[model samples]
Every structure is written in structure tokens, then in C-alpha cells.
Target: MIRDKSFYKFFVILVISLAFQNLLVYGVNLADNLMLGAYSEKALSGSALCNQIQFLLQMLVVGAGEGAVVLGSQYWGKKDLKPIPHIIGVTLRFGVGIAAILFVIVFVAPTQVLGILTNDQIVIAEGVKYLRIICFTYIIFTTTNILTASLRAVGIVAIGYLVSAATLCINICLNTCLIFGNFGFPELGIEGAAYATLVSRCVELLIVIFYLKYREHQLNLTLKKLLFIDTSYVKDYIRVSLPVLLNQAQWGIAQMIQTAILGHLGAAAIAANSIAVIVFQVISVAAYGAASAAGITVGKTIGENNIEKLHEIVHTLQIIFLGIGIISGTLIFLVSSPILEVYHISAEAKVLAKQFMCVLAVTTVGTAYQMACDNGIIRGGGDTSFSMKMNLISMWGIIVPLSAIAAFVIKTPPVVVFALLKSDQIYKILPVVIHLRKWNWVKKVTRAEI
Candidate 1:
């Protein structure tokens, strides 16, 4: 019980720090969407569609960062700081390579990707312009993610929150000036949002690079480190990262499919669903950040072979997430209407968003549970294979099919489809609960001959 209390105290701090970090990411997103919607309704939908491609790319980058956290936490536990450079180098190399390829696709074939998301000519034109302006931002954004993830792995979570705050401020200032034609800047409209994002990302990259130079011990980036390709370390990184990458791809594609389904309902549904998702993500990232912190802390503990405290820590983290989930979800439900007003969507769309948010509010606990157990506890324990398999079954086998049935066979409303899509979270809880209780996840993964 004493151990539980101690863990809870630490977890509370983690949650608070993560809330600030998420404030930066989500705050920028909120302001970006509002500025787009307020300036031009078409821009809102267009940016929404363009962001689908960007979102998939981001998932890949974030997955690499996640892999970085997994390795860095365990490596830090073992006091193996020597290999930190190699790990960062390998992750960044692979990430940058992938981002280059994606950038080509976005630049060379922007319309082709937009076509997959929508058929509206106006949306397609705006989305194409948005993609063209923002494609270069991927390189900068990917680097920021890798650097931030490496820092977090070394217990520098506060820096990430600070960076996020800085990014939010820069993004807002640039967006306002560029979007609204302030300070004699041409009113670039929707395209201005893209340019603002691009400029802000560059600034974020510069900050991260400057910080890395000053704090070289925390980050081990060097010319030789970047040039020297260690096959063995690369192999280990791939072994753990591939499944996670696949999991993210599967989850992201499934979401795109769900979005396409919502698209068929009407433009209003698309706009409303997009608005609601951004709002919910702001709330959700708090829990997400906490879970990320938990995974790192737990992985560090297991690295030291402190097996006795594992279960207590996991339980405490789970409880912390539960309380956050409940309270946050309830607030979301109560203020759903006011929140909807922030978006200039239709009245019908607002109603649908409110109902969908209510359902999301009720399911937050389940979502939080999965984040702590599956994402933090299991993956932190080096059970990546199991985590991948579970997401495959839950997202692909259950959620996709159910969403399709709701959309096609039942011809349900978008709200109903959105609700059905959330079933994966509910269905996933049982396996996570069973897995957590077994305590097999307590073993140290660093000694597994990586």
C-alpha cells in the first residue's frame, strides 16, 4: 500500500506534466481549425481531408518515437548511455528516410491522395493546395518528435511540455498573421494555415536542434553517429519497431476508413465529426501522456530488476488513469454544446457531435484502461508482439467490421457509426485486464540479447 501511494504521487506529477504538453499540441490544433473555419468553411473541410494524409505520416513518426522511448527507458535503466547515440541515430535515419518518401508522394501526387478522401471539386482543390504548402513540414516535424521522445526516455518530460508550449505560441502567432492578412501580409486564407504550420514546424525543429547541441549528454547526435549504420542495432530497433509501426498503420487506416464512412453521411457529418475529434483529442492526450510516462517509468523499474514493485506501480497508474478518464469525460459531456459552437458547423452536425461526445464520455474509462494496460504496461514490458496482435484483433477484426456493418448494412446515421466505431475500445478491456493480472509482464527486457 505504501508503494502504491508513492507510485500514485509520481503518476500524478506525470499526468500534470503531460497535460501541459498536450496543451501545446491540442491548443495549436484547436486554433488552427478555428482559424480555418472562421476564415473559410471550405478550408475547414479541405484541411480536414489534407490532414488525413498528414495524420498517417505523423503516426509513423510517432511510432518510431515510441520505439525510441521503449529502448531508451530500458537502456537508461541499465546505465547504457553509450548506445543512446546509436539508437537515436538509427531511429532518426529511418524516420527521415520514410518522411522523404512520403513527401514525394504528397508533392508528386497530391490530388491522387485527396481523391481517395473526397470527390467534391472545391474540397479537392483546397486540399491539394493545403498539401502542397505543408508537405515540407514533415521533415521538421519528424525530427522534433524523435528528439522529444529521446528526451522523455531520459526523464526529461518537462522539456517536452516546454517545447509544446513554445510550438503552440509560435503556431498561433504565425497562423493569425498569415491567415487573416495581419501586418500587411497577404490574406492567404486556407493556404496560409498550411504555411503557418510549415513555419512553426521549422521553428520547432530549430529549437530542438539548439537544445540538443546545448544538452549533448541528453542527446547523443554526432556526424559519425548519423553516418555509421550499425546493422545489429538497426536490426534490434526494427524487430521491436516494426510491429508497432504496423499497429499504427492499421489503426490509422482504420480511422481513415471510418472517416470515409462518415463522409458518405454528408459534409455536415464530416465537419462535425472532425470538430468533435479535435476537442476529444485535447482531453484524450492528457491520458495519453500519462500512459506514455507510466510506460517509461515502469520500463525503468523493470530494468533495475525491482520486480516486487511492478504490480503496485501498474495498479497505481491504472487507478490514476481511471480517475482522469471519468472526470474529464464528464466535463466533456456537460460542455459538448458550448464546445460545438466553436466550430461553425451546421445545427444537425452540432446535435450529432453532442450525442457522439456523450457516448465518448461514457467510454473514456475503457479507453484510459487500454492506454495504461496495453500501451504502457504491456509494451513497456517488451510485450510488443502481444500488443500488436491485440490491436490487430480489436481494431481490424472487431471495430472495422462493426463500423462497416453500421454504415453499409444498417445505413445508420454518422453518430451511430461513430459510436459503433468505439466498440473496439470496450472489447479490448477484457484482454488487457486479464493480461495485467498475470504479472508475466514483470520481466526485464534489456537482457533479452537485443
Candidate 2:
């Protein structure tokens, strides 16, 4: 919203970085499934179920990161780094605590944890093995994600992608080596994927720490500073962050429930959905990039008090988002048929995948707008409470119930149920457009802080 040509450069850089970040993370999941599918369809379904639970944690980490981004980005945008350390401290406190609890639960009751997701015995057995091995990643992910989001808040956007790229390379190499017993390693099968993820996460944390240390002065961050906290700053950060945390936490749990519902239909449905989800992520990478850039753009605009730029930025972003949604959705539709022939999956799963993909292609249009407005424009502008309500109203108020009814009560087709699960994307479209026109989010969140 700063309208300077340089602002566009920053936006483009952040978008590309965020897109790549999502790709690297989700690409790892896709790769794991591909490799495991080659091992066995049961292994693929089993690991995918485990990853869904892991995805919930990832969303929690992202929630904490979003809070840090909302506060830290706004403060940094105002050229005052006073609140950054305290915000990180508070976010990590919650994130680390959640990670610890999840670890304990998964460690102590691996069967129960995996059991909640699936009913198939073979998939459940593999999922239990995967869960036990991967639970350690929760805490690692908590710390790493907080740092990544916090760094991005302060204009170190590309660093996250660099770190993810390196980590992914390690993950891929490890997966190939351990999963298949290459390089004289034992064939660990599905469990090998978990080991690879754990090792890569550890390496990722170390890399993030070293990078932050090297640039600490430039970003005004330090170990002591990260460890320290100011009560007033804590309160301020909490006030602005609670809604964001709730938004993601609630949204994540709902998504997990949706996944569980799919899982219950049998391993075949779960496997099909997993493949479809991977394809959706691959095609929708640009939307993620755009959403990430939107947040930074809005936060910078508010921090800099560039009110005149609001109308122009909002209108232009909406146009760009519309195009992104349409283009990505088309890409998904175009590739689904060809992709099925290549992936190692059954005829039944392939048929279901095609059905699920058609739904994804259409729903992605609404999803693009929802992400752009809610994540980018609204949350970035410090309108997190508004976005939270929209998220809850759309998902809980609409999608969840519809999905439940479609999947259980009416016992509809898997594709119909999938469409119902995605209804929130459609529900959010017009509301976001209406809200953007009002310009309520244009107010500066950093005015009082500075």
C-alpha cells in the first residue's frame, strides 16, 4: 500500500518466497506419500492419516507465527523493533507448551491417537508406527515455525524459503536412503519417512538459529532478547494475537475432524483424498504466495500510516487474487487426469481422486479470495478478530455441519461430501469482498506502540 515501486518488489519477493515455502513443506508430504505408495497402498493411507494429525500441529505453529507476524510486522514496519522479542517469547511459550502436550499424548497413547483418525487395522498399525516416530517433530516444528514467521514479519522473507529448500533436500535424500535402504541404510519403510522428517526439522532449527544469530543486529534480535519479556509488550501482543491464534486453532481442529470423517469411510477414500490434496497444494502455490505478501503489505501500510494507499492496494490485490484463483483452479482441472496415470494408486482410488479433484478445482476459486482477504488483507491489517469470526462462521456455521450431514446422515457420495467440506470457501467469498470495500482494516495498529 506504500505505492512506491519498491513496495511492489518487496511484495513480489515475499509472494515467491511464501509460495516456495508452502511448496517445500507440502512437497515433502507429497513425496512421502508417493514413496510410501510405492511401498504399499496401505502404507500410503496410513502415513497420510498420520500426516493429517501432524498438519493440525503445523496449523498451530502457523497460528503462532501469524500472531507474531501481525504484531512484529506492524511494529517493524513502523521502524520500531521494541515489541518483536516479547512477541516471540509469548508465541513460543504457547507453541512450545502445545508441542510438549502433543508429544506426551502421542507418545503415551499412539494407538488412541491413530485410532481416532481411522478404523482400518492395517492402516492404523502403520499410522501408529509413524506417529510414535514423528511425535518428536512437534516441539521442533513449534520452535522453527515461530522463528520463521517472526523473521518474515521483519522483512527477512527469503531466508525462510532458503532454509526450507535446504531442509527439503535433506528430507528427500533421507527418505530415499532410509525408506528404500539405499546407500547401505536399512529399509525402514514408512517409519523411514518419519525419521527423515525428524532429522530435517532438527537441521532446520539449527540453520534458523545460525541465520538469526548472523543477522541479529540487523533485525535487532538476540538470544537474550528472545528470552526476555516485557509485561506491557506481552499484554499488547496477546491482545492482538489471541484472535489469530483462536482462528487457526479452531480452523485446524475442524479440518482434522473433516479428515477423520473421510478416514472413517475406509482407507481407499483416505488415500484418494490424500492424492487429491497433494495436487491441490501443488497448483495453488501462487495463492499462498499472494496471501503472504498481502499480510506484509497491509502491515507495512498500517505501520507507515500510508492511508492514501489503501484503496488502491485493496482494489489491485483483489484483481490479482481473482486471476490467481481462476488460473490455479484451471491448472488443477487440467492436470488431474494425467497425474493419476503416473501416481502409484489403485483403479478405485484413481476414480475417487478424479471426483475429489473436480471439487477442488471449483472450490479453489472461492479459496483464493478467502485467503487473500482473510489472511493477507484482513489479518495483515490487524483485523484478526474479524477474520476469526469469518472463519468460525463460515467453517463451523456452515461447512462442518454440511460435511457431517453429507458424509453421515445422508450418506452421500465421497465427492459430494468433499464439496460440502469445502463450502466455507464459497461462503467466505462475497463477505470478504463486502468487507474489503468498507476499508475498516486500514487503521494503523502500530500508532499507539510507536
Q: Residue 60 error for model 1, in Å?
A: 1.2
Candidate 2: stretches off by over 4 Å: 1-4, 447-449
Specify the highest-TM-score model's number. 2
lDDT, candidate 2, at 330: 95
* Off by more than 4 A, model 1: 1-9, 447-450
lDDT of 1 by residue, 266-379 (tens): 666767777777778887877787788788888888777787787677766777778878876877788787776666666777788788888888777688778767878888
lDDT of 2 at 69: 88
lDDT of each: 0.78, 0.83
